[model samples]
Target: MTTATATTQAPAPAGAAAGGNTLAGTRTLIRFNLRRDRVRLPVWILALFLGTLATAGNYKELYADPKDRAGVVETMDSPAGLAMSGPRHYLDDYNFGSMLGHQMLGFMAVLVGLMSVLIITRHTRTEEETNRAELVRSTVVGRHAHLAAALCVAVLANLVLALLLAFGLSGMGIDGIDLSGSLLYGFDHAAVGIVFAAVAAITAQITAHSRGASGMALAVIGVAYVLRAAGDVGSNGALSWLSPIGWVQRTYVYVDNRWWPLLLCLALAVLCAAAGFVLSTRRDVGAGLRATRLGRPVASDALGRPFGFALRLHRGMLIGFGAGLFLMGVMYGSILGDAEDMLQDIDEIQEALQEIGGATIAESFASMVMVIITVVAVVYVVMAALRPRAEETSGRAEPLLATGLSRTRWVGSHLAVAMTGGTVLLLLAGLGFGISGAASTGDSGLFLKLVGAALAYAPALWVTVGVAVVFFGWFPRASAAAWIVPVYAFVVGYLGQILQFPDWMNNLSPLGHVPQLPAADLSWTPLVLLTLIAAALVWLGLEGFRRRDLETN
Candidate 1:
């Protein structure tokens, strides 16, 4: 009895085990992240507002007449237009404001969603991948707190965008444009942005890698757009009801002005955020609910050659991009195929058609579609060219360079795939668009016309690649320089139509000078100029890379 029993002790509580979780510390981290992104975030918000204001100005000028408005409504009411553009109800006054709203609102929503996706993924999956999450978790921060902080920042950014859009549009002298309604429209879009951000957050919790999380979120955005489009075109308004984008569109600003739809968007956003938070708590640090399985320890035959290894690494992205472009091509072609029939009922539309048409309606549509396809093609090329920088920053390129492979061969292999793959992707997108347009028109020759138009964009696309390569080689610290090249092109090409930018500024974009194929006659001088520029830039980049130290971080 006197013999002391072995002393039993209880384990310390997890509050004492790891550390106590603190909401205040997490809030401080949020502020730190916000401070780090001060310049970038403000610029993005300003851009969003400026884009909306510019659209308002452009629409006011383009559709100043009632006849013009009516014609637009009639054409938009068609199945194809409805699928591509959304319902045509607000086209009645040809309320130029509403027209701009209809044509550009979806894109704005997507842009905001993209911004959200990138921000959330960067803070969540990216931080986890870099091992920063473990360090943060060692403090008093809760498992779900990081996500909450990230979401808080996203919501704040979106709210600023909404306010700016409302303020900007109000200054444009748009008639009967209710400030409350417009703000609601912006808010509705912001809600969609928040929901997608939440979706991205949830994806990060369920996927261990940043790429998978970002891809998953983007796929959802794409699916939502498709579903909403299909539902709108099919006359089954019910289907549109199922999409968050549909909720934003259904708000019907300057028309029915149904504010209730916005409430639905807010609800969805909240629910998604709640679910994401729950998921974050259930998962462990640096691990996802859907764990990333290990690949084969041994290399496959596909990984045998330098080129083959490049292909293997990029195959998934390439296939995904091609498929997306193919689908977009088909949808665009199908929509434009019906444009002629849709416009026949409206005199103003007929006049507009005459303004835009060539020898035939098919040719005119082909020209417009080609311009779109070319822009998308250039985007793909830019993305491809930037892959070298991504590889270097990710540390994948170092090992490859450490081997017998020379820097020229290593960089050249990636560049070769980028150049070749970009061309193939553009061709496929063009062919898909052309074939679909031809099938709708019941004409076999239309394929050649469409494909040619698509190919016409190659020079401009090459210029974008060259710009990226130059940045990658000369300014390794500024990986984002490549992004600016395309952004400058986009601003010059599209912003001119919306805002009254200077002539010299517009001429800066290669697309601005590229002859509008199938509409305008092709000119060789501009093409030659673009080719020379691309070649010069590539040479400069190569020389810079050869002389510079191989960047390790």
Candidate 2:
């Protein structure tokens, strides 16, 4: 009987169970990510889609005559216009399809790329930072599951956005915007997104923090844009081929309807994603391939102070945004000298500029550019304002709260940074714009005027930060809604006149209340009022944060 007993076999370890299947839990993660992004995905998709539709519809209204289109085409053919929009070849056809492809596609693709980068970083590195990925991995998850899932989510988002644009744009019954060209345009956005998603996937593996990963990926986008701009503006069209952004633009979607450039995008995406997977395998969980630098063994005096500590945490992002704003200012200012000349031929644009009330077309353009510059600075403000919430949710706030640090002090430190840092960013942008504008226009007075124009929006910027603070204090989960302020401001304040939107709609944004400076008489009343409103909002937020229970992981 003892001899007849069978030998028992033990099951393999959980890790061993998956064997070489590094992407074992990908499907589950994709579903989980999709569920988490339901609201976010729709908002991004709808905003982009509606904005495109509105812009496309207006093209017809704005340029009904062939001469109008041809005149605009001449403007676009210039180096300044080519750098801002696309290549000179886009002017060949200049149909609604070509117009849409030239003007909107590159900008739309960059936004989509940003969307994709955020999606990947949020799902991959962000999860790791929060320790959520570790908890998931302790189960049946595989090593590459998170990365694969993130890529899948990004792909899905791009695909959906592409499909929506394709069908929606074609269905509008606009001439020259055929389904084929629309599809090409839509997929061009998706291609850029996918390429950047791969870039983010690699960046995530390199950096320890999600923000760093995002920054690295965004920097790539910036480089691509710069390269594209330089190439398009220069005599060498081949230089444009070097960048992924330039690659998509070269597709000549509406003109030639070429589809080959997508192959390059696909190749790069595959290569980058594969590298990310290999890198993931080389590193430990919750750690980056590049080790974090060793800090001073002893705590510094600044570390003891809440404001200093908060600044330390925000230093990288602040510097990055500051540099970016300055460069953007310079770029915009570079074209300032020719702005009046470019618009001189376009009667519709001239009339619109007249309505905006500038002393000159250059001045009016500078005023509008100021609004755009401020809107960008608002991005930094919102991020800085929301930093405290991130700290609170991450459980770091608990240790500090247990000490002598009060909630108000802790939160105030970051708010101070948000407010002051935003002002600094605006000042830097103003200086850069002024320097470049003066050089471009060869008018020294224009420099100070542009700088003043940039600073004029500071009150509106603070108000934007205040909205984020209010959301962070009372509705932490919905803090992202604060972004609507800037986005709305950009749309209504920048394009509202052109789109013929009602004044009431424009007034809905704080930026709308701002006097278009340099172009119009600067009024102190609205600025003062906006400042008071911002102060009140901040106080309300601090009170709410003080009263409510802190969120903890």
Name the best candidate (by TM-score). Answer: 2
Off by over 4 Å in 1: 1-19, 22-24, 88-94, 338-357, 440-443, 494-507, 521-532
Full-model lDDT for every candidate:
0.74, 0.88
lDDT of 2 by residue, 278-298 (tens): 998888888999989999898
Residues 1-553, model 1: lDDT tens digits: 4987798787544322244443436687689779978977888888887877766765666566676567667768777777777666656545655676677777677788888998899888888886787787665666666787889899889988888777667666688666766776677668788889988978988888887788889888888887788887775577788888888887776667677887887888888888888887787788899966788998788676677777765666677678878888887778666667554544443554465457776676566556566666677677777777767765777888888888777776676677677778778888888888888878788788777777776777777777878888898777566676567767655544334457798587877777766666778898889878988887777777878877654
The collision pairs in model 1 are 22-140, 69-94
Cα misplacement distance, residue 111 of candidate 2 (Å):
0.5
- Candidate 2 stretches greater than 4 Å from native: 1-11, 345-348
Question: Any idea what lDDT model 1 has?
Answer: 0.74
